[model samples]
Target chain A: MTKMHMVSALNNALDIAMKADDKIVILGEDVGVDGGVFRVTENLQKNYGEQRVIDTPLAEAGIVGCSIGMSLNGLKPIPEIQFSGFSYQAFHHIKQHMARIRQRTNNTMSCPMVLRAPCSGGIRALEHHSESPESFFIHCQGIRVIMPAGPYDAKGLMLAAIKSEDPVIFLEPKKIYRSFKEDVPEEAYEIELDKANVRKQGTDLTMISWGAMTRLCEETIEDLEKENISVEHIDLRTLWPLDINTLSNSVNKTKKCIIVQEATKSCSLSSEISAQINERCVLNLEAPIQRVTSWDLPFPQFALENYFLPNKTRIKNAVKKVLEF
Target chain B: MAQEQIGQFGINHVSILDKEGNVDEKLASGFTKEQLSEMYYYMNLLRKFDEKLFNLQRSGKIGTYAQTKGQEASEIGSGLALSENDWFVPSFRELGVYLTRKVPKNLLVQAWNGDTRALGNPNHSHNLPISIPIGSQCIHATGIAWASQIKQEKDVTIVYFGEGATSEGDFHEAMNFAGVFNLPIVFFCQRNGWSISTPTTKETKSETIAQKAIAYGFKGIQVDGNDVLAVNKVTTQAIEKARSGDGPTLIESITYRMGDHTTSDDSMKYRTQEEINEWENKDPVLRFEKYITNNNILNEQEKTDIHNAIEREIQEAVEQGLSVEKPNPEQMFEDVFAQMPEMLKEQKEELLNEIIQMSEQNNNGGNQ
Candidate 1:
């Protein structure tokens, strides 16, 4: 095992996958020479050559639409959007073609490609560079949505997404891209998609989150444990095709739940999970389900980003509210 | 500082046959009798099939249908220029292209009937499904060609769209990518006079859609879309150039819609009878028929035989399409993912149980 950050781990996964499969290609703006804006694909072009690692023009829709075409022609292309905010430019292609090609063609043609984008805030970057838009992709059908919290799962989940037969929206938490390091496997490995990872187990309250928010939840749970409050922390690796079984089991055992997300609360994945928990384990709940998410307002500038994002204080307050209820 | 001109570019127009069936002998030469006859046959077949589909929509047998009444030559002519190894990416309203590519006639019928099975097996067909969203397929074609270029393959990709599609960002992006990569692709735009109610003048202020390619650093030409020979000749040259690594070409085929955009539209609301009459006089099928007769490629008896055969073939396809069994509702849940997730599986089970209970309730009510 090698100690690596999320960026290197993702780059290693792409390298291993490309070396193994000639049909696997990587394409996006600055992906070829510069290795992506976040350097998640560093030196991929040098290793795989320009043919496999392409530097596309500055057009988001073109990158995605071309990836769909490449997928149709027996190539597994991974196209990266510079940031999650810019993905809206390609939303039409994502919603219309990439997500529906298989169902529209009745399984005759399947789009087996992965769209990678750095998402969530905390980097103090420019505007439109740090927005969390996972909810938009989760609402789309015929596509898998995934976000890995750390280096270990980043490598594993990205490999799995590359191998998936269906289109996958792989959202990387750019905030923690290089913030921390973890011991990740050197060789190829795959984490099963559509499953949640149980980070810690307890019985008092269930703490559920994904992506960068999961790291904050971890800190919150640790602090809560010191105060004699046992919390079961779950990191949702795959957002869609959600592992509701794990969530329901945890909520049932704990008899309480609090969901956190970096994205806004309205019509979000947190809302969906909250509704699901109520439907499945409502009778077992000792308290009302709580949600700690960013406000419905647009993601604010860097000066107020910390205030906008859900922090340890907000999460701890929500935990207290659920426990008191 | 002295004034200087950086670049100079010019657009060329190609027309091998006129409305009166008079051919430019030099340009129309070298087409074998079999090839000429096949072109005539497909154009006529497309026209007849289009009429039948229009009738089907009127009789409520199918949904709203787009009629390829007068632009048959533009679609079939370019379609015929493609080799079996090449890819044919189509926008909607390319039924003639599908027919020329030899897509099963019943599959075409099934598509208009709102069935997913109409998208023929991808493993066996090089033609893509008709993209409903305007101009979206251009980037897809560019990518396919890019893939071929990467793999060092000789196959080419040809994408078809209308004049209005040129205004879309995807179209320009695709052209730019094709030019930059020197990918083997053909952008075949049929200037079919109108984009629904909007005319070409409102679509673009440019003198001709063909010149749009020059801005992207490639060659572009305008062709007489009503002249089957000209479209075929121009497309053949472009295909050859692409296969030989000369890069992409944009051919704007000048044609007319000759009918409403689809069954839901009424051209009379926006166009004049005189204009329709003018286009009717330049009908692609009649023009092609006249050319083939003048050149002795097909006699009157052979024309009659081909017409009857196409009529019977279209009728058989319609019957076959109607007779096919409806897809099971469970199929809706199957293709969304290769392996159905637990949530989808549970939902499918719930739907199935609901259906069973509804049928049981009806039976019980009948007994009561």
Candidate 2:
């Protein structure tokens, strides 16, 4: 009903979910009073009271671990990790326990919790603030990982994540928290977490990206068109339990493809997707799938952050390279 | 950001009831006599069931078993501390504790038999599934406690581990989170003096596990774990503190793992028989029996009947748990999702058909 930014959309989604379910709790560091470092949880405590909106001490493992317990105890917990890069501190819970909990307990129990982290680079923030790490979660089976490309996607994906019976990792694009605004509906709606959305249509090439990278892809197409390159764009909202049919159909049409992720270029999630594409559509390929990703280096300081991240120019160059091939 | 420690731990020990069945005026008993007797009876059941399982293992009826014999006081005492709605997150060896919480005896047997489907969740009671990974339960317990407080639920939580589990990173993280947030949790560490072959002397340089709480800004206490009365009293106080919203407490019950670490281990490889004998003399169950008998609380006939009753009950549980039908191979893949995806369904059908064909081929070969 109103034009909201990405963070505002998230706040609205959480507020709506919590208001509907008494068992739902919002937990994380500074999420209660300060409303998160980015204000995504702004005014939640004032509305729900301290019992529902909790500000936990800074420990990623504890946040995720406890959320699992809360979920088992009949509460729907929405946990915040402050930033995506810091999630490495909780790999034990995520890799060993988070997804395996239901399997560990013979499906007698499940971690019906959602972990919210601000992912992807471009905000020019500190080193760890803007890194994308969805691949680690994508590799996990029982758990679902997702990211939103815009305000509408953020609200819809968050609502879906909260409603899911299994544990979910909802990665928010931090750089775009306030960058764009859209008319998010007042009536609650859920965009399926496993379905991918095609942002634009073209036959020359299909550029795939998610999170903040989708915005850059849109910009890249704008410049690529100046040179008369009509490109297709696929925004993958959810990474795990992927909507492969969407990618296959799009790739089948375009033949040429480029995968742009803000995370590192090594054996990342994009590698898995590329392998899947090659296996499924090998005959239709016009060239090898190209990846425009960050280098395999620790996220550098903000001073050198620009070089560590992929920008519009990088995506355009990747498109040019794919087209030339 | 933190508080100061009063003194080093292991120097002070707590006890409430005496060997003569007299309650200490200085230490208050939290529960009535009826509740105390119920807890004592559960401990007796645990002891009898443990003996049965150990015998089963020795006779080749079951696989390796973890005997929770001498540590009954620690497990039962802590188990009784939780209210109906509270959670008891425990490690695998706390069989005595798990029994009190209704962890289906059959499921326990099924899990030990290597059938993953037999594993149950903490839903059996307000407790969690038995955690095999050391010290991992503490973080889960803290999480549940945090959620309870965050959701304004009246339920508190208790977590069980051993002295050796303190070394894990998750343990430190658990304490750090509980301390900072003032979470409602009771941390019970059964200091059984040894973790497998590693002795407490080399576990850590810290004087006492209880004192570790002081470093994290919480109250810590040491109790005579073999003294059933003391374990009950100390656990009650710590659990009550958590229930009242004062936050967590670290309780170190100084006991010994009177038997081998597990049925698969050999204590003789590392420890002396004389030490085991010394601990056997301090058996919590026998001492409590003596305390009650000496006071003329029960005649010899009554004691005999109690033992016979517990044996009969344990035998029934064993028979029932073993009698349950074995899980089907088809059901092994269930519960992963409410609705299995098409790929998993396809894979399951393929595996089942392959199994059928393989069986048919063997039958045909036998006929030929």
Candidate 3:
């Protein structure tokens, strides 16, 4: 095993999927000879031929809509919706057809495809470029949604997403594309899409999060531990179809759970999990399931970003509140 | 198909069949009596189905249905024109043609009844999901068409939409892709005059909806949609052209919505009584019936018998639709994806248990 960044991990995952299935194809705005804006798809076209790696026009609907057709025709398509925010352009296609085709068609056909979006804040990108819209997709029923927190998880989850029999939205955290490195397995291995990994186990309290938020919480847990305050950190691999068993078990042991997410707190995935915990495991709770999430406001640019995102201080305070209660 | 992909600067209408049960001998040679009769019978069935479903809506048995009254000839004729290997992609309003392609009669009723389960089978042919948002299927059709072309398959894709859909960006992008790649597709538009309350005149001021093809460097046709013969004629030529490697052809079946856009809509709100009367005179089904009967192809008795048979069959279909067990409200959770995540499964179980507990309490008749 060798350590690699998120982009390298993604490259290895594509190498794995493409090698396994000849029907697998990669398409996006600049995914062809130019590799892609982020170079995540670098060397794909060269390895697999131009027919498999297509450089589509700058039309999100065309990219996603056409891929649905291609997938229906028995070809596997991995479409890149350049930026997470840019995916909104193809929202109708995804939410309406891509997500519901299997159910609407009564399981006679499945749109087995993957939509890879480089998502979330921390990258000082364009206005719409950095946004966490996993909650929007979680509201949709038929598609699998996952946000990988690191290089290893990205490699494993992307493979699982591609191999799955249904549509999956694989959100790659742009902020962590090159932020961290870990030695991924030399032999390709798949990490399940519906399970969250235990980043650290502590008995005092549990901190649940996904994507870039997990890294911040991981850092916060380090400092929190120094003050004799221990926290259980969970890196949610998949957002929708959440690994509630793992989350509930941790909440049962710790007796308190704090969910951290980059999206606004209202009507978010965090809200769904909070409601579920209250309804399912309310008796075991010590205090209310605290949420360390973004305020319900349009994400501001760099200046006020620290005030918006859940960082070490905010998370530590939430941990302090739950402990005191 | 490439041989027929000629760049026409104006309308390229290619019709041979006429309203008076007449056909141009040159194009008629390809069709047999059996094929034409099947199309005739199917179109009749569609008209009858529309008649009964509307009545059911009035009686509150089924939900609203978009009438295919003046557009059956267009849908039936065009759908019949495609080869078996070719694809048929349609919007929600075109369920009549979708049924023609073998979407079950029960499914048609179930879908309108709010059971999306009605649209559940595709083993019959290449049909995309019924699109509620107009014109979106056009791009999917184009993509499927290109997939065939790229793979060098002897197939094509035919997309159906209304004239109002031309205004959508999806329509523009689909046409652009069809033109650029010269994909084997037919952009079959049913120009049923009215986008709900808005008339076609307000939808676009273009001289003809078919003329929009000129913007994308392809041939376009303006057909008298009420005449089944004309719809069949242009559709056959377009299908042949696409089969021979010609790019997409835009055929605008110029017709009118003879009934309300849906059961809940009031056509009187948007169109005048006089306009409705004029289009009623040009109803596609009536035009075809007049042509067939006046020519002695199908006598009055034969027409009555067919209509009676269709009505009885539709009644049976309604019974079949309603006869099923009270739908599994739990179906809302099943088949969401190929598999439910453990959490959803548990959530579903919890919901079921909660319902069971509620039912138990309600049996005591004081749970409110």
Query: Which predicted model would earn the best lDDT?
Result: 1
Error of 2 at B349 (Å): 4.2
If ranked by TM-score, best first, what sequence of candidates would result? 1, 3, 2
The alpha-carbon RMSD over the true interface for every model, in angstroms, is: 1.2, 2.1, 1.8
Better of 1 and 2 by lDDT: 1
lDDT string, candidate 2, B229-338, tens digits: 78877777887888889999999998789878889899999999998898887777777666566555566786677778788777777787667776777765675555
How far is B258's C-alpha from truth in model 1 (Å)?
A: 1.0
- How displaced is residue A256 in candidate 1, in Å? 0.3
Cα-based lDDT for every prediction = 0.92, 0.82, 0.83
Q: What is the TM-score of chain A in candidate 3?
A: 0.98
Query: Which one is best on DockQ?
Result: 1
The C-alpha TM-scores of every prediction are: 0.98, 0.89, 0.92
TM-score of model 2 relative to the true fold?
0.89
DockQ of structure 2: 0.47
For candidate 1, what is the DockQ?
0.77
- In model 1, pairs of residues that clash are none
The order by descending DockQ is 1, 3, 2
* Candidate 2 lDDT: 0.82
